[model samples]
Target: MASPLRFRRSSERWNDDRIIEELYSHLDSNLGARSVTPHYVGPDGFETRRFEMDNGDMALFTWNDDFAYWLGNTETPPALWRTSKYTFDEVPYQIARWGQRELLADLTVESPWLAKYDYLSWFFLPVLFSKDGRETSRAFFRKYDAGFPDTTRDEALSFYERFLRTGALDDYRYTMASKLGTSQYFDKNRMSSAMSEFTVAKLLTEAGYDVIPEIEVTTGHSLDFRADPRNGSHDQSSLVEVTRPQPPTQRAADTPVAALRETAETKSNGQLNEHGGGAVMFVDCSGFRDDEWSAVVGEQPDVRHRPAVVFRARPSGAIDAYKKGSVPLSLSQAVEWV
Candidate 1:
């Protein structure tokens, strides 16, 4: 894969002269230079200018609303006030530093690439503050607006490519909550559960496993949470069964377990009669309780087989595995199981 590209600082700088030159180059052919005039500079360092297009339209630019306030003066010179009544309202078009930052922040929140390369802040400031600030701002905004959809399309394509290469796009999505107007941290258990399931399914599909989810096997009238359809023919079939948080003790006698076992046995027999015998494996993920495990084995179990995996509720919160003599799985260990 290619390394990520960086946006250069030198490419982002903008100044008054450069802005004026660019605008002149753009408008010169249509509106002759003779029609353009430099008026006055403001106390805040913004240049006020006026221009007449060849088509006879007039426009003005200034830093603050001083020009507008002056034009409203009843005693002001009629010549100045005459055109002042026609003055373009540049105050609304003027960009403040904070406003520019806010705009960049909004864009960064939506487009990961902008934030990824740290180019949003550099790009927005000049566009919002240059001499032709209004035009620059409009152009920049429009460019991003037009490009966003394509950027999103490109991201989707990239995710698909990664999926094909890695058999899983584990980091493609995220979820979070908010409290007191602040974003709450992710719940690790919830995130792990979702990611594990998604990654497993994606990998299986990529591997040509003919995977199915929540499949209903007719022989035992049981719903298999997941299955690989390619494992068997009509008479004989092999399948893997997964159980999570083993049925609660309250429902220990649920018929699902019996039904699953029956399906596996029947499928094995059918396959054996038709071709050869097949094996079915059941993976039980009912993690052990710390206290129960310690009482049974007299010590803590290995980190990989810790029981906290079964009862995890929040990813950011700690589990009390110590109470039951069990331990939580490390991230690396969890990934291995997945």
Candidate 2:
């Protein structure tokens, strides 16, 4: 767990001159020579301007939309508003690195709006690193996400430094996923599910499988991950469904085993055709144990899915497999298991 993020709402009155200076200070570093022009869009709208950078990148900067309102009264600081855009496409690594620097510096004095966005960049920019086709990078993070920071900009900067120096970007995606899930910014369930799916995909990839996350095999049916053995044919592949099981305190109507079985059986009978050999199920068993899961599966001697494999994934990254009549194989080995 990391420190909680804090946002300050200032009620102090500000004039156009100071606001313009703060805007220029944050924007001029990336944008070169430019004239400042501010226009009133309306209440709840933004004051906007355009500038061109020395690097030939064009940008539009928006000062606080709420700043004009807070000028007369100091009751509550208006929500800080700032946005920027580049004419040319910018790379993810560059943006991530820039975000790291921005987060380290104190922006509360000049412009908290950019600071807020910079903090969010910590959550979003790393996504590009994974998107840039860095499977290993994504895998390392997904596996060791607990080592990274989920909140607090300073801690994130520390994590980024090591991530950059090593060029591994370990735990970056997972950290972002964790924040998105807990943050008030996004839908909790969607973020949590995406994080779980991403973790499963990365785990499978690290296990020597080339995985596709959230792949839709049929209408209204998407497996957490679908992967083929690294050097094998599609027939050797498996469709994996992942779940983050809940504790008894948080448990609802169903158990982890029941959920795992349902998902596996859904594609048990030619659902995947010959594209996948079988189904691999992973339950985040940090809330449960191997013996507990075994008890549930043990009752069903002849399971619906004959070749189904269930994995109990502990929070510490340990795994236990329960596939009747099959050898005790690691996840990678099971990928090619017959």
Cα lDDT computed for each candidate against the true fold: 0.30, 0.40
Best by lDDT: 2
Model 1 RMSD vs true structure: 21.9
lDDT tens readout by residue for model 2, 140-163: 234333222223334433333322
Query: Candidate 1, TM-score vs. the true structure?
Result: 0.22
Off by over 4 Å in 2: 1-95, 104-195, 218-221, 231-235, 252-281, 289-294, 297-307, 324-338
Question: Candidate 1, overall lDDT?
Answer: 0.30
227: Cα error in model 1, Å: 3.8
Model 1 over residues 229-270: C-alpha lDDT tens digits?
343322222333222322223234343333223433443345
Clashes of 1: 9
Winning candidate number (TM-score): 2
